[model samples]
Target: MGEVGLRTVRDGQRVLRFQAAVIGAATSQRGSSPRWSELVVYRMVDGHYLISKIGRSTVAHQPTCLRVNHRMVPWSKAAAFGEDSVQRVPCPDCRPELGHGIAPDTMLEVTRYRAILCQTAESAAESLMGDRAALLMPQIVQTVLAQCSESDPNFSRYAEADTALPRAWENTTRTP
Candidate 1:
């Protein structure tokens, strides 16, 4: 299980809240899920946010990863205001796992996929920006495929199984 803490301060006043979620080990068929409790806020400086995350399960047991996401509030109503404003900053810790096709690779891919999705969601939140969302999804999917293709020759054969974001979205949205 993992816990999340959110703190917001306006005009020098601070408020904090915590939430928890359960996480499980990675399966051989796909990749490992993130350890929710392992998330730590390394820093939140300027408009950039950084986080340290732990991988679920792999031969390495636990490998720490870093993520950088952008934040900005757009003034234009046509632009998505709350969505992250920048492409995810590159993560250095998972390079070895990315190279070796370990559990880290899967998590990295999923993270990238979500970044793209969140970008789309941000765009969709605006009336005029919604059109941009259609353009972004395919581009993100293609990028994901290209990255996988470059890293693993077997990527295409396993595309439907290993990294189908569409199915992942569907499965995630399905009601239990």
Candidate 2:
């Protein structure tokens, strides 16, 4: 695997704990996102922590940084509470490659993540359990979140709210 990137640590211990939670969630819901299985963690030369998506598929694996505020709340949580928080810029090259004639500029909405998760769960349920009930299970979503959490401590906190999986895949119009 390539050196995904660097992860800076403002508080390593807390970030590690959150990382575990993310991993657990991802493992439990492997079927949620095809990209989930390819996630990895790396510590940067600068001492920052990075969670990278590393796979041969079109899915994007961008690095995000983690930080905490005075109340001991994670940056994501702090954002929810209306506190100023550190931010990570999206990877300039990380864009989804839509296949089968999808327009280049089409943006994937946030809800698509939920739809994809639900579809995957429903397919699994239908094939294995003989019922679609598994589609509605909270455990699956939790697993995805957990995996995301583990891959990047800030993943669940940051991207979960604002980033859309499909948008992340859109082809950038700018020339590098």
Q: Give the best candidate by lDDT.
A: 2
Give the CA lDDT, 0 to 100, for residue 144 in model 1.
Answer: 34
TM-score of each: 0.16, 0.18
True-structure Cα RMSD, model 2: 20.8
lDDT of 1 by residue, 1-176 (tens): 22333433211122222231111111122323332222222112221222222222121211333331122111232123221222222234544333332332222222110111112211212211223333353332333333333433433432332233334366478676
RMSD of each: 19.2, 20.8
Pairs of residues at least 3 apart in sequence or in different chains that clash in candidate 1: 2-36, 2-37
Q: Residue 102's C-alpha lDDT in candidate 1? A: 34
Candidate 2 lDDT tens digits, 69-165: 1223332333343322222222235543333433333222110111111123223222222222333434434344445444544444422422212
lDDT of each: 0.27, 0.30
